[model samples]
Target: MSDSSPLPPVRLHPEAELARDALSTPLLSRAARLARWAGPDTRVDAGGGLVDEQLPAAAELLGLTGDAAAAHAAEAWRVAVDTGLVEVTDEEAGTVAAGEDLPLLTGGSPHDILAVWLAALEAVLADATVPDLDDLAEAMDESGEIDFSRLDWDPESEAAFLDGVLGNLYLLTVTEDGPGDGPVPLPALAASMIVPGDLGEPTNDMLEQISDAMMRLDDQFRLLEPIGLVAYQPVDEALMGDPEEEPAAPLDETDVSRYGMVRLTPLGLYGLRARLLEAGFGAPAVGDLVDKGADALLDGSSGYGPLAARAETQQWLDRREPLAAARELLAAARGSDEGAPLRRLRCQQALSLVGAQAEPAVRDVLDDPELGGLARVWLSELGAADVPPPSADLVYWLTIDTLAAQLAAEGNSEELQTLLEGLAQQHSGFFAAAWRVGHPATADVLEAMGRLHPDKRIAKEARKAAFKARSQQGG
Candidate 1:
């Protein structure tokens, strides 16, 4: 995802709801439990982790029982310390207490609870970058220090790779054409980072790199799941046993899940969006324009997909009376700027959601030079009584405006090509009069029609009309 362009707006759950989810995540819940369990008796090591002797008690307190229970408890304790859910009061004494953020989990607002969760997410993400326990053990030297060369890890690069993977996952979840809330295959996700866009076929080296990346992602996603960042299906153990083994049969779509599948949880979306915005990415959310004016709503959502735009418009409309909202939209749609046609198109869509209560507002604009044609269409669509017929000039102006909006929204699209062909076929004299329409987009629309029309004769006529229109405008 490019940081330059805004991301598709995510529809986040309410903060209070997300806070409840945050409090419910295993990692944060465990950390919170350990925080409340700590008191004067709780002792910590120099690193602020629970001392080994106290790990059993801490694990028991959290009802964890397994060979790895102590390790889990220790992991939660580290998160608590790092996120200030527990604080080391005296470093030399190695004493600990419930930190300042602990109370926020219970008594503070939903925002406060989410703030602590975000901190925990950060800590966990940092840990995910580190090699697993066995890898660390191998990297350790006789002097008990980690040999950086043996580790073969660059901290900055590892963090960046993970960030890129999560960013792509977030993009997939929020984009209209992407698999929103669906589990993406792990191989495909890894390939998104490894494969060049223009590459036709993957070589052995590229496939091997993707396989390695998948294994790393499997481990990272496992760590992330406990913190509620992803719902992961780990790579099948059978697939990992031997890198050179051949399958009995070719893999099919039905068996793809064995490779692995992952989806971002709703809570995860909220967390990642917050992180993206903090990193200076233009990550927008659906209800962001609810409090803004109609002009802002139309302008802001001009780039949104159909479903998202409708959702945003509905939220904006929910706040005001129908008649007033309709009037405001029409007023905002009457601009001569470059973006005006698309804005007007968005306005028409927004007004469609309004009820008959807005009929007066639509009727009131029937005489407006810029908006009259649009108002007539709306009224006619609603079967409003006594709608007046539009003049030839009004019809031609509306045609240019509509075509301009379509071109802006879907540049050189096949559907627009079909529309241009049908219009030319229906009206033999269209170009002759279209060049005279007073709309700002008249010449541009004619030129687009000329370029897109497949018939040479019609294309020539359109080009001629475009030249006439441009000359008439003294441009």
Candidate 2:
């Protein structure tokens, strides 16, 4: 037997190297800068007060238009408040104007942050153990408004949500993460906020509308994580690929109550302590806490959500497991019997689970007559998306053979006729099958072929087929 193997899988982004190299292009560099800056809300501690005018200035520095910039900052604060990341007070806003340095929020790369939230929802679904997830609705409203009074954001559920987000964040950071240094600028931040697979990129006008909604949410909820008090750190290189590395930071020490009055009670300091311990940091000795400024800068940058939800859950096998799954499914199929319909159906289902990995194995099974029909159909569907279109000669040959087989099959002549008619209409050259020599014709297929002949061999084949029809009729 001849031996050959299917080609290796195609990666869609073959231009990755070129894409990376082009990051230095002026437009992208500007995008990267903006992504860093627009990532966090501006906050300052005015003694016990809050200062926010610099919010507009910071927005301007990020090159935002007056109305657009004001709105962007509002949205940043809104995502923070909604996700339980921060709290703000007008008192602290004054402090921000006075230039007092304050603690920043738990921060990391934007992609990591976004991944945590998305994966949190994904993890909730996966953990529920459902096969298909199309039925689930989002946590927010149909009007895109978050009614904080309505949500039951209990500590346990919030913690679970946080855990899901953090786990997912870890996965994105370690596996498919990208790079951006310095604070992301506003435009890039706004652009990235337009989630992938969303209808279209958000325009400045859309950003303004989003900002307005955030302002409304802020008025209703109050910004818990005050501006100037928290800033986002640049994504470190260490978080890029090492799944096992301990996070190079710790959670902030501010009490959840310090952020705002919310629908649910914030997890207390003790809970934060337990979380830190779970994150692999040893609790500080009693004396150590005193000197570290009665305050701890929360590791606003934890990697928990993405890691657990995405990396651990999907757990893509490096090379062998998919092939192994296919082999196991196939073995189970073969032990049943050659001609059994149940066995045939099992093999088909198994091959589908094996997906592209089972292509070769299923093709081999095509040699067995019992498996041929099922295998050919699988191969056609799976292979259609992969293989280039067939040439006219191959199409012509297959069309004739398939038509002949349908003619010989006893029970479905009308269905077969419909199939042939559809094929002739869809593919211009299949008219020969519709009018096949002695079958039916207005003039003749040979004359039609002669009139349309672009290639000498095709015309000859048409003429020969006509003669063969006459011979079969005992002409």
Candidate 3:
């Protein structure tokens, strides 16, 4: 995802609810338990990890039993120390205590709890980038420091690769056309990073690269899941028999899950958005424009998808009286700027959500040159009584405005092409009079119609009309 463009607005659960989820995540919950369980008896190494001798005891305390139990206990202890839930009191003696942030988990506001969770998320993300301890041990040099070159790892690139993967997952979760809550196949997610957009077929090398990345992500997501970042279904253990083998292709539709599937949890959405904002990305949320003015609402949501725009408009309308909101929207919709047409289009959409109470406001704008057509359409749709018919001039002006708005919003989409064809079929003399419409977008709309019309003769007429309109304006 480009940091330059704003991400699709996310619909986050309330902070209090998210905080509850954060408090329940396996890693954070284990860390919090260890924080409460810690005392003068709890010993740590120089790095603040639980001493090896105490790992079994810690694991038992957490009711964890198995070959990997000690490792899990050690991971939780590290998170406790990293997040300040368990602070080392004496470096030399290795004494520890419940840190300053521990009590805040039980007593403080939702924001405070989430703040600690974000810190823990950062720690987990950092850990996910490192090679396994066994690998590091094997790469240890004579002086005892692990040789990163031997490990074939670049710290910066590893972190960036993980960040990029999570960023893509976040994009997928929030985008309208993406699978919002559905699990994305792990191979597909990995391929998004490895494969270029324009690549038609994956080369043997690229497929191998994607396979390697998938294994890396499998490990990473396993670490991330305990912290509530993702709900991951690990690649089937049966598929991991030989690392040298080419990635297995799913035999059937049901077999795809064998490769793995993953989705961001709701808590993950909140965490990623916060991180994106801190990193200087414009990550908007659905209710962000609720308290802003109508102009801001229309302008801010002009680039939003249909669902997000409606959601934002509804939230903005929920706080104001219908009539006043309608009036404000109509007032904001009247502009000669290049963005005015879409803003008015968005305004019309917003007004549709208003009820009969806004009928007066709609009627008030019936004589407005810029907004009259919109007002008439709204009133006519609402089945309001005694609405006057629009003149030929007003109809032509409205047509230009509507087409301009569609052009701005969808950019010569198939739907616009269909609309253009229908309009030309309905009115034989459209291009002749469309060139004379007083709307600022008249020439541009005519030019778009010329480009979009399927019929060659009508297209030529549209081009001629556009030229005439531009010449008249230039004068």
Candidate 4:
């Protein structure tokens, strides 16, 4: 149907609306009933407005096997207690007994179940309430890679939520699974989960739109950037409106959400549902999602710090904007030339945020080797361009001394290689470090470096170390 096709009316109340407002206006209802029942807040005797008598069949509806269903119900009950989304009171006589399952009914079809999950997630996100990690895991696992074809949502809504859930779940899982070194970075996890086929049979245009939206999400929220790299919930200010105030629906017709939103306009829902019915839309391959994420990050944010700069840069990159982050950094640095070292540092940082792309400019700042140690070091770490190998032999000797001392603790040949590779691509000096470590005295020594390099060079040197290790083992 055309975008302006006649729509079904909003059907909140069949009683009053029968004679009033145009009945043709399509009404998109929610899946809260199903979500409430299936969510962690539902227990056998309490929460989710469920009665004890409903337990047995509810378990069956959930498709839980035997005692597993009971267990699931109980866990939901416990979750209810913990999150305070619901409450349980002692029975004063025979009003209701503990351990009894409430009879809950839902018009929820498969798509409805999916819709409910998306709605819940959106609620939690908007409220900044962290989702119950375990509950989501169960849902995703049970759903098993997800097939929107069988789901009950409008096609657009389905695609939007699928993308959103994938993004969020990927981030949450990564945070928990990541090495406990720093604030959980969604990018790393997003990078891992995103791979081919994750978009199912998405068209190139759809992918581009999603990419652009993700980049925007990244710029607004750094922690969420990597997740955006895969999936995202684009805020439809018109649809979602201001949570604290305003009517239940949006007033603006022009405003549309790029990412999936729990609430959708009639047209949006219509489009989504229609797409769901259309053939070819399938489960996106995890590998493809990951690759997309990696490509975005690699090309988007070169390398600065605070991590937020990368996030912002990613936004522009996603749009395929001509003003790439590298040029942006250069402009910033050139503008701040007369400022304090702090300003220079900030500009450098901005450049660094652009990563390897800004290396040349970074190297240009180090004409005076005496004051360039720190700058050169940063360039080296990021694999930036070089400053002509320190023209003076004495300076070269000092540079080598400093480098050797700094790297004295032993290094992974492969990890060093990767690190130097980034730099070597820009400045040949970093490659030297990788080469030096590649020929370390022994396999065990190189292995030790791979295992213990404190500077995070292991990723860079791991391969070279492996090669050297095999060579040594053979000899």
Candidate 5:
């Protein structure tokens, strides 16, 4: 008998560090019980998500009821999936089993349950809740053009879409609820989702967007909260006014508006960040940059989105003594090769933060070619030296480096294949040359593309470049 099975994921897991706090222990235990009750071969209906068959049992087990009982039931089932208790699958596909190796919850240790959930969570996240998140993450590698209009609203990508909506919620939260911060009001979170406040005052249109966002939130929470990805106070049906029967035909409406507050559970954060990190995106918080050297700091910040990079850059600078920071900045800038000019400029910006103390280093580098223009500009800004016209190559290198950083940080292989192909179209010969360039992480990044790309030809090309780089280094 011949049994053909696909290989397990290699690079994505083992790097995932699941966090189990006091609150998560019980949820994880319940999740384990849910999985155990379902058995190892729980079968989902053929044409839908795993929630269909398990909701009632899950809802009852979780002691959930009310107008939101079904949602809670679905969420608990999802938690069982996310926490490694229940695996989502089609009974007919035989590709996956809804109950693969899941143990019954009777006296199951928290550590063991958490361990199982961690492994399953990585797999689920690897196969993103948002199916086209591959393309979406790739789009972020550049101007981050999100064609929200094209998002698949089907159950498959609903979770991933929810993750994006959550991001908008997260941005609204940072000031008040920075990483590891607590919950914000549901109204505020939903409002932020509709109008990020980017365009000044909110308008009526935003209300519609908020309502839409809430509907989506309701859908997500029904499946997510029971499993514990989110914790919130469900909408109080009692708050609404009694139905007004008028002389005219009455309007029938079901108020699905959600309220109270919601935030990612510790487990949710770990799972999402793991997906981002695996795809080469920057998911680190500001604290990760504290105490790092200027070069390392800039390198780390390079992959972060504009807002986070700026915040992280400030935090990095704030931690250092001015004179010492300036010296380190200049040293880092001087070390930047043509391969990474943006890093040099970022270092220069950090130097400027050091005030007049940075003047001496600027003076010392004034005679150097690659850095002289920047040096003179910093000095000139302070009325100490003449500013030279900016160097063309410096600007060019910066542009390319910026693109490379974004590409490496966020572009998945499909995007990588296109980006590399586009670069090849522009440069006379690029794939071969890319490995030689000073862009940090190029070789490793290319290797990741090689492994994940959908097209064999592009995958082979990426592999070739990675090999060439390694060979050149060894030589």
Candidate 6:
């Protein structure tokens, strides 16, 4: 697939796209490069894929490490196979590289490779056998020296039980965290598998069974870790039965989430996104614009919250010339919409980013009573021709609106406090007069200022102004 592959119908928040750019794309690129370096026949015998042999070379290329513990060759191979940059084929006895595998000689789109990786994950799961789980479970049982209860799920075939672990692993891994950055703790992952989702509370027996199963299920990691699909950081070994060693206590839910915070690797994040979308969960895109017009971009952004709106709008603005952006923004502000006042306010703020060239269009709006306050402020900020002072109510509304814009745009608490101090200095009875300002947002703006101001005295004054405005409205 190419970048032209249709994404989910709904546009997601910008953060989702940003995470992939910052994490996933880079990981895929590195994996592609590493795979090519490892060559076409990158064969892996039952002895863990011959990954260790290539570690020094791959590590040098990726800048990870060539040394035994630091080597990430295993992880590189996992990424390569998952991303389809490197192909792993079945041999008569073990796994071998497919002869026709084409290396991703150049960088491919993250979205394209992510789809391939996800398809592969589903394919492997659909075809995986019970023997796969049994081989891992046997190894885990030998290490289970701690007290644990076997699960009541008695399957005549251990294969079914093994498959359950894999299913539980996949489900738990997907639900664990967002843009999951850390590896998950095996105990926590195992406990989630045992915890009945329908039960309001599980019994103590279930908890014990889950704990033991989690330890036994450590075999999941034992199998997956070698392929570099997962990794672990053991906190401490249970120094049980040794008088000199402190006794290790059973892990509780709090200890489980606290001690071992498992995160997915970038590769895992890529694969899991596919799983999430398949489950009908909405995956976010950073800057998928529904419309490119200034109004559409500005209006479209409001639903995404402040940071996203700013990011979304800035991205839209960056693509167009400043003069064009200013004109479109001004026209969007003049739309016959339900939220005209708010739109006008937002438009003026966006114009500031377009700079002085926007002054003439902004000046033309000064005659409109609703936008008069904002236009005057825009002119002043640009140091244009001298403008007569606005009326006291207009002044009150304009100052409050300006502060509100700052609160939304700049978010400077100190600047807000300073503005309040200036109002106090300029007008001895600022709050008393502010209570009766003639703008629609007067009360709301004052109320927000009061609620958000850090200074107790200023916040009190703002609250007083808001109360008076409310009383006036009621009367």
**Local distance difference test scores for all models:** 0.93, 0.36, 0.93, 0.36, 0.55, 0.55
Which candidate number would show the highest TM-score if scored against the true structure?
3
Output the better candidate (3/5) by lDDT.
Answer: 3
lDDT of 6 by residue, 333-398 (tens): 763334555566677667777788777777777776667777888888888887657877787767
Residue-level lDDT tens digits of model 2 in 1-475: 0013211111121223323322332222322333344323445443321136655654565466756566554444333333333334354332111111111112344333332232222323223232112223334468866544454345455344434332322222223232211222222332333334365766677777544433222232222112111122322333233667765774333432222212211111122223434566443211221122101101110111222222211222222367654554454444222123333343454456557877776666555533445556677878645433444443443344344433332223456546644654476654444334333221233434433454566556556656655555566
* Per-prediction TM-score: 0.95, 0.24, 0.96, 0.26, 0.42, 0.51
Least accurate 10 contiguous residues by lDDT in model 1: 246-255
1-475: candidate 1 lDDT, tens digit per residue = 7789999999999999999999999999999999999999889988898899999999999999989999999999999999999999999989988898899999999999999999999999999999888989999899999887998799999999999999999999999989998999999999989999899998899999999999999999999999999999999777765548876655554688999999999999999999999999999999999999999999999889899999999999999989899999999999888899999999999989996878899899899998899999988989888999999898998899999999988899999999999999999999989998877788899899889999999999999999999999889
lDDT by residue (tens digit), candidate 4, 265-329: 22222223333334333211112122233233332222222243334434434444232544444
lDDT of 6: 0.55
lDDT of 6 at 33: 64
Give the TM-score comparing model 3 with the true structure, all chains together: 0.96
Off by over 4 Å in 6: 1-75, 88-103, 107-291, 299-315, 321-324, 334-346, 386-389, 406-414, 448-465, 471-475
Ranking by TM-score: 3, 1, 6, 5, 4, 2
List residue ranges in candidate 4 displaced over 4 A: 1-53, 60-68, 89-364, 370-389, 393-398, 401-475
Better of 4 and 6 by TM-score: 6
Residue 370's lDDT within candidate 2 is: 39
Local error of candidate 1 at residue 110 (angstroms): 0.8
